[model samples]
Target chain A: MRIEVHLHPPFTQVVGTRTLPVELPDGASLLDLIERLRMDYPNLFPSLRSPEREEEVRSFAIFVGGGEVLPLSYKLREGEVIEIYPPLSGGVVPKLVQKTRRLIC
Target chain B: MNAGYMGKVLFVDLTRRKTWTEPLSEAWARRFIGGSGLGARYLVELSDPGVDPLGPENPLIFMNGPWTATPIPLSGRHEVVAKSPLTGIYGEADAGGHWGTALKKAGYDGVIILGASEEPVYLWIHEEGVEIRDASHLWGLDTYVVDETLRAETAKTAVTCAIGPAGENLVKIAAVMHDGRDARPAARCGLGAVMGAKKLKAIVAMGNRRPPIHDRDGLMASIKAAVPEIKRLAESLSKYGTSGRMTTIEALGDLPIRNWVQGAWKEGAERISGQRMAETILKKQYFCGACVIGCGRDVEITQGPYAGVQGAGPEYEALACLGALTVVDDLEALAYATELCNRLGLDVISTGGVIAFAIECAERGLLPAKVDGIELRWGSPEVVLALIKQIAHRQGLGALLAEGVRKASEDIGGLALEFAIHAKGLELPAHDPRAYNSLAVGYATSNRGACHLQGFSYIFERAVTLPELGYPEIQDRFGVEGKGRFVAVTQDLMCLFDSLKTCKFILFGGIKPTHLLAWFNLVNGWGWDLDRFMEAGERIFNLKRLYNVACGISRKDDTIAPRILTQRRGEGGAATNLPPFGEILSQYYEHRGWSPEGIPTEETVRRLGLEEEAGKLRAKAVMKV
Candidate 1:
């Protein structure tokens, strides 16, 4: 099955596209799609997951089908469109600061 | 004299035509800090609870924090405080520009305007002198004209904070505008009406004096260490300004659409977004004094109906309120409307809110089909522009709408109340409470009535975390548990920001309580730890709450609009979830150590060193009974 993904800024800048179509299994969960994206764009994963707790995907809010926040375990349907929004308050500060220090130093 | 402060406040009695300078009480300065906190302390000391907000006795305060005129980033801001004509409760508005810096440079920490003038007048403060000049000719002029005229009359470098015809007409939703076309407005609580009631037109400040810094070297080192990261983190914000978040907020169902009834307006959101603005009319970015993040937009409409519209561009609130909320997707028209609001000294949030409310009222036959021969319709740019004029001039339907949604809803009667979205008379900002659960509680308990900046706890739920506040990791925004404590903690921290006159956006750059405290200590030569800093914030928050209590604000008044509370968007990111308001509010009260009636308890007040404020509240309560 093919799923459509909408990426808002920083993510768009990262992924080099506003929208992307990816092929996934019919029974793929939201987490599975996230893993797929992580595999596809390794740089995007760091932003999507919490910096303090990497296992937690609390950094970005993922919405599907009319803007409902679904659980990561929720199954994705064929032709479903997923919208990923970067944190409205900006990115994770600690990691960004570390990265910024690395660049500055 | 304390370091980092001007050490004195100028008091002007318009009726007596007398000016005096009072030493800023060192004890009170330590207790309240400055800006909103210090202003609140002075307001309570000066005025009674039941005084009419627009009356001669209700003092209007323009206050600067210790950080003003300092080299600290995002320190170029000030607070305007008065009893609100709109809410009849504790009121304040914050603005970032050069005015606060100018005022500090003019050798005053704040200015307290007392009594109503028999005629129009303006204050010219330069260096160590203040002259109250006749502004009779400046009357009825727009803010732009007043700003320019005052600058011309004073020094060319003078920064003018002025009110336009909306304020002159005593519009309840009027704003005190600054920087003219590069508009920065302390645009809430209708304090501009208070200025108008005093018959004071503009305040022009010009000076070269910088507030004395205790340890300039240390403060500069700390700032230097933080500048690179602050700038890097704020890159997107610098590029797109605040409107950059439009699409993201829309995606989260946080954007108020169609008077906050609709769940989604994706295409419309994209069209008016900062990204769209950058690709269109966005000419440059505007920065405040000592600002690292330039989130202010400067745009020009060169070849459109809004061709003449230029200068400060519409921000996220303006775009959401004037564009998405009204279902008007025309970015250019929204830009024009924003400029119009600025020129007329009208609060953009309230202007958009009243316009939206009027349209909804008209839809339900609560209003006439046409007001002033112009049809009232949603998504009509011409109608929106015409209504803005009418509101500022108090012409026709504009007069009723200018009273703000709370009064206008009551006047309309019937189902009109159903659509009037406000918390305690003040209209809600662009952010919807349903999208962020913390906002529901924050809006209810906020002292200034439904202000996002007052609490700003939603930022924690979204992106940031305060390890010092016991949140080492981002908590579940959807979860109801512990949100009460979360909001209380964040609100206290936000109070510190407001008092310090620092932008809350510094949180995005990973600024912690320690950093804030370090800056405070470095500037004032005080060794306050995290606990002391947080306590000061708690004291400030409770002080404002005590003031509100004196004004008869209780648990009954601490609530969002019924529609916002009960109605579900039923689609989009926030679909089908009403905030569990009761449980969250109970936890909030428990955390705040307030009684169920939402009044600060004697023990809590005593603990925070607010015994005097509590005693005043008790006195007011006794007088009422």
Candidate 2:
């Protein structure tokens, strides 16, 4: 299955493309797509996961079906456009910036 | 003299042309803690509740905090408090710029203006003394021109806060702007109308001396501890300015769309975002005095219709109210509107709000087809720009809009009141209550009438935390539980911040209550623990509530637009939520120790040392005991 990903700023600059089509295996969850992106772009998602349990991750607010979704266990349909936002959601940049410092440490 | 305060307040009686300096007592400083608290203390003592807010009897008080003009980052702020001409309640607006610092340096803790001037005049404050000068010439100029002309006449280094024609015209949504093009407005509360009614043109402040600090080393340590996080926050802010998070706000459905009638405007958000501004018209970043996070924008449209349109902001609030709410995706036009508001000294939030309300009325044929011959419609950038000027000048249909949404809607009658989004007569700022459940309660209960900054629980609702305030963990913005307590706690915290004249952005830098207490102690030499600091905040909050009670505002006044309470968004994070406002408001009353009617209990007042205010408020009978 193929998913359409719309990258927002900073992430857009990081990925070098505004819109990218990524190929994913069938039955892949939203977390699967995030994990693959994190693997490919190591620097981008340094603080993307919960420290206590690395498998548990926070994805960019997923905007699909004309609304935002948590994307965890959210099954994707064919031709679904997912906006994988940076952890920077709504003026929450300060928190994310602080989180980045902790992750680096 | 206290270590932090200049220990003197300047009193100017405009009618008699008398200027005198009175020593500010140490006990007063300890009790009120300056800025909003001190200003309100003065206002309550001097002005009567029934006094017209635009009348000569209403005193305009300017106050600075202990941290103001110090090495403390984000301390260059001042509060303007008066009986609001707009809301008719406790009205206070905080502004960032050099004026507050300069005023403090000029050997005064605050300035209280009593009686309106018979002629247009400007107040000049220097280290030498205070002078009430003839300013008949400066009365009609734009704020930028007044700033320039005053700086050229008074010392070049002097900082000035002035009102433009909107203020002079007595437009209820007018603002008192500071520092010209890098304008910082004490725009809330419609204080500019009060200033205009006073016949004051501008205030010029220049002083070289810094206020004394009790423990410089200790304060430095606190600042140093907070610097790393401050630097990180500043980096992001400087890169994108305040609207840096525009896309995220839109995605989260926090931004108001189409006059709060519709939601889901990602394309509009993208066009007016900070990223787009930075990519296109952003000329440079600007900063307030002693500010670490330079979230201010200086932009000019280099090409297109709004070419050479240069000014300060289109902040996230402006972008939402002027852009998304009006459905005008033209960023340049929005920027031009921002520039116009700054120049004319109008509050962008209220101005945009009033204009959006008018657009909605026009669509329904409630408004005249041609407002001074200009068509009113949604996404009509040209009409929006023209309406702003007409409002400032108070010309024709603009005169009705100048009275603000509540009055305008009342005049228009019929269905207009249903969509007139205001509380207690003051217009709401950009953030939508639907996005964050806590805001619904916060907005309804805010002392200063639908102000977001009065109790910015939305920040905490999103992700911010303060363990000292008892919330160790972040709460869900969508959840309904615990929000009543959340609004109560955050309102108290914000009251302290407002009293201190500290920037709310400092919260983003991870500064906690401990750091703030430490700095206050070091600066003022008054050693107070966290509990005591919080006690003062509680007292101040109650004091303002008491002030409102005296003004006849009761539980009935703590409300929002009907549409917000009933309407659900079609799409977005808050798609299904039509804020449980009443339920949360009841919970808030419980946490606040207030009666279900929203009057502070005797026990609560006694605990916070607000017995005097409690007694007065009880006598009013407006506060249910």
Candidate 3:
């Protein structure tokens, strides 16, 4: 089977990639794939594993595609594109700031 | 007729113990407006061509722009200008809080502080008058305490700008923290040290007089029209906070890791991002005066190792430099270090960079006999925290590091100094200029050393578009093409914002060029249009450049350190991307109409109405020599 991944404002850089076969024993978790990806991308996983304090690793978030995913074991189909977008910033730019008045009001 | 302005310039000479207010002249306001322009005009007049930055001759002026306290979005801001200890040139840092508003309320347009105080004191401004209060007891306290004690003791919630231990110690990178809690820093140019050297603890202002408005009804209606556009942008900010950028910055490989060793932080960036904060630690939110967007995150550490240790919490830069850059993942440690900088009255960016540089030096075996066996190991959160305390007090190895990155690197010696990412003696902020090419120029040519806010090219490079007003499409972040054009345009715009004392976020919020024009027209009753406003911005930029030129900095000096220019991030999204500094700088020189060596050309001087002053300056130079 195959999967499609979505990129925002998608144009430049890598569009998508074909991943390894998704044949897991019975009901392997999504975390299993992430664990696999962790092995695949060591640099990406560097911050996640605190060599000094293992407990600090708990702060990270994993997003599949664009939104939150089910637990890691929530298995993925063969071609599903998994986006392990780590603890990305939300309110990314605009938040509690001075505002312009509403035109309608 | 000064219609919308306070119509006076308040002058305070601490050395002579004299205070006076000068009625505003029509020409000055018409040309310079407020904030950066007024700041530059004032600084140019006060500073000698070759005056020592640390000497008493430096003038620290605080200014507000036309839109400052008006009903415009993010207008609660002001500027501080002095000859910078960091840059050995013109120094300026703009801050946002209620202080700018209070200055207006006190029936003054701007305040120029010159000379030095004989003893430790603070200036108190109420609606009625100004008083020099004894600040002997408040002298050694941290900014938090100074702010709290002033409010408690004086019965006034006066917005205060106070120097911490670093400033009092005359650290070159010391910052003047405004309002105390927001960390709304006038955090560049080492202006805080100027405050400290004056033996001044703080300036507390709370006044009730309203600034006269020309088109009050029209302005109010315009302001009403702006409120919703503001709310839409601010709503996200209030929810996410500024730290919300950590993970994304980390993801983009923009986060500075290990003194800019890598683009991505190894210490899980997402873990410290806003989502994690909201889920794990965030408690309440905070805001400045009339500020709709409250990016201040109040956090509570619970159920973790750092649990129960509570403070305002660590922002992104701290998390980057102290955390990932130092290889420390303890959020508690990051928060503690940030609080320590606040306590010690230090610039967090400079302080963090200092520690990171020290770590690199220590790892490189540059620690000498003076280090007293202190381990400068990278990523050692405990030691990093301890050193932060030490730097504040200038104790042991901390004493050496407290001298800032340049002197510290000089003392440490070896290849370690090469890795020190500094421009104009001040350590660069958390952003790796190497990753963001335009930032290289920003860091190099900033009025204050190594400031990101001064140029703010990152916002443009990172998909922020203001295309409705016809800004060119932000070039590729990794590309150096059109960067000079980008930097020149952005620098002028920043000058405008800095002078206007408006939040940088206002640009992102679609405040429109027309809004600023209207505000300017309303305040000074100047018939100035948008082109004139932009020209004022350009004039201020060149004026600041002239100050640097007078201080003897040349094109040769406008450059990033070897490491930032040559080294590429070893890992992360920005791997293999190095700033095309030389190319961009050449373009920048061309854009500014400067000589290849960075001197302002005669043509530019004439075009900008600086030709008359240029002749006078040349005549003065010959006379002095």
Candidate 4:
């Protein structure tokens, strides 16, 4: 199976041109693909080990096609395009409340 | 109870050119709390059901909450409310930094401007008194320059909230800017236009009076306790700033793209994320008044043809809307557009939406080929920048754009109105609601229209958990049944924070839902139960609702944009799900004790102690029609 990855902003330079092919054992999942990629592009992606994050579980978000990619147990087919992304916060600082901390420098 | 507190509301009747001071009672402050609640109460007293937003009858109030100037993390915030020129509903805006604190220190809780100014002028407040000064020279200046001039003239260190050229021209989406150094905008709901419509340029305050606290020892102790959490805030926010979350919002499929006609910009979304921001222009971090969490970004675009200088950030939502959502991936250009809005005094979110809607219309051949010497195209940062300038200056192409998405569509005469992407004339923020059903209610019921802070159930709805509270789980982000319950609970919790004037970021630390109750227990010594806390929130929410109803909003108004109800994301979290907004709204109505039409029911009015007010508003609304 061959998969392509897309990155945003300045990271577009890190989006590799090489289409790495993986020999999957039957119905290997996205986690498996990520594990394989971890070996190849160790530094390009964010890992579950967030020194700042207090949670115990290795947390990350993945999406394939148009929906949020579920847990690793889900199976993947050949030649499907998957987009991996990370989480961000802070929206809405109602002026009446000014709850949002977002500001210009 | 010290002499330091203003304990009064200063009134400026621009229409009559009269001024008066209304006493602030301990009882009133105790019951209504402050900030949004106080402003809502005053607005209810000031507006008639059918009052024109731009008319002299509409009142603009700049008010601060009780906890505004204290050492609380991300505290020191204030609110502005009026009949919104943009939405024709309730207009509002809020800000932090020296402004709110200075207002309190200047010996006033808030300034209530009762009528239109007869000429261009600005309000200057010192320890002595509040005065209206000629502002004809300052009227057209950008907010930054206005702040500088005001500071220079005041000959003191007072902060300012000033309007720019767009506001001066009465652009419907104008913003009121604060913090001359960092440039914080109370930038939604067109209050700046109100300021502009009245020919008011800025409110400058410089005073030595400190805000009074009932218990200094207790306040000092609380501040000390919150310090640890505040310290940690600097690390998380200072590192990436709020733009840091763009990648995360993109990952969750929450980022709005292509005028919300699409969920993700498969072509260019990632190019504007926080990691991307850091790799490029990010320089120094900025702070609000005493805020340990310096979420403000200082960046310099020292690359390409647009090299050299920097400004504070044009931050998160603006970056998403003006940068990624419109498919305008050029960081420098979007940053420039953000700068233009600051200079022009417009809301960047609405600007982005209006411009994107235009581009979409132009792409669909809805706009005429003869539009202002150029074709508007998606992903073309130049066109976006051109429109921002046009909209700000209200030039030929900009004149139509100045009317905002709704009016622009009407003028252009196309199916463009269908893609305007607003709720009740207010543009939705950069977040896409298709990914989270809770946002449907948040956007629908937002008093100012399509706002996020009113009910920030996003954190609760997402993977971030308050485990001890036993949440409904992140997998249920799209679920409908329990949303009303979640919305109500979060609304109250947020109200308590808004009342206390605490920063929302404090929630990430140990300040859970019950923390407000604990604070009340320790301070003010109110031994109120959780039921009382929740009831206060319900009352405040209901009061705001009644205020809206007084201004002519009804069940017909609280609704989601058609795009969220009918569309599905082809590349993110909501791929297969089209939100049943009507169904969720039905539940929200039930939870809010409102009728199916989204009006507070008679039974609910009585229960919330608002039967008389509701009746009067209902009658007024009917009579207006």
RMSD of each: 3.4, 3.8, 8.4, 5.8
Greater TM-score among 1 and 4 belongs to 1
| Model 4 bad stretches (over 4 Å) | A1-86, A89-105, B1-6, B230-234, B302-304, B466-475, B520-523, B622-625
Instruction: Determine which window of 10 residues in candidate 3 chain B has minimal summed lDDT.
Output: B616-625
lDDT of 2 by residue, B172-219 (tens): 999999988889999997899999999999999999888899978766
- The Cα error of candidate 4 at residue B400, in Å, is 2.2
Give the per-residue lDDT of model 1 (tens digit) for B1-625. Answer: 7898989999999999999999999999899999999999989888887889999999999999999889988899999999999998989999998999999998999999999998999999988699999999999998888888888888888999999999999999999998888999999999999999999999999888898888887788778878876765556677788888888788777889889899988889988988889989999999888888889999999996779988999999999988887899999999999999999999999999999999888888899888878888888998889999999999999899989999999998999988889999999999888888999989989998888988888777666678768987656667798999999999999999999998988776567676787789889988777898999999999999988888888888888998888999877778877888999999999999999999888889989999886776667642341
| CA shift of B521, model 1, Å | 1.4
* lDDT (Cα, tens digit) per residue for candidate 4, span B324-377: 657878777777777777777888888888888878887888875447876777
DockQ of 3: 0.07
| lDDT for position B331 in model 4 | 76
User: Comparing only chain A of model 1 with the true chain A, what is the TM-score?
Assistant: 0.71
> Compared with the true structure, what per-residue lDDT tens digits does model 3 show for residues A1-105?
443433221110122432334444445455665465456555434434332211122123333442223343365665565554333211111211223222111
- lDDT value, residue A33 of candidate 1: 84
TM-score each candidate: 0.93, 0.92, 0.84, 0.86
lDDT of 3 by residue, B1-625 (tens): 4665677888889998888888876676666667888877777766675666667788888887767667666778888888777667778877777878887777777888888887898888777788888899987888888888887766465677788878888877788887766556777767888888888888888877777777677567666666655554444356666676565566566777877775565346755666566666777776655666666777766665555545566767667767877777766667767777766677777778888887777676676422655666766777777778788777778778777788778876777679877887877777767557789988887766677877887766653443433553434667776788778877887888887667776544445555666666655566776678888888878877776776677777787678888887766667777888889989999988999988889889878887655554554331221
Per-model DockQ against the true two-chain complex: 0.28, 0.17, 0.07, 0.14
Best-performing candidate as measured by DockQ:
1
Please say which candidate is ahead in DockQ: 1 or 4: 1
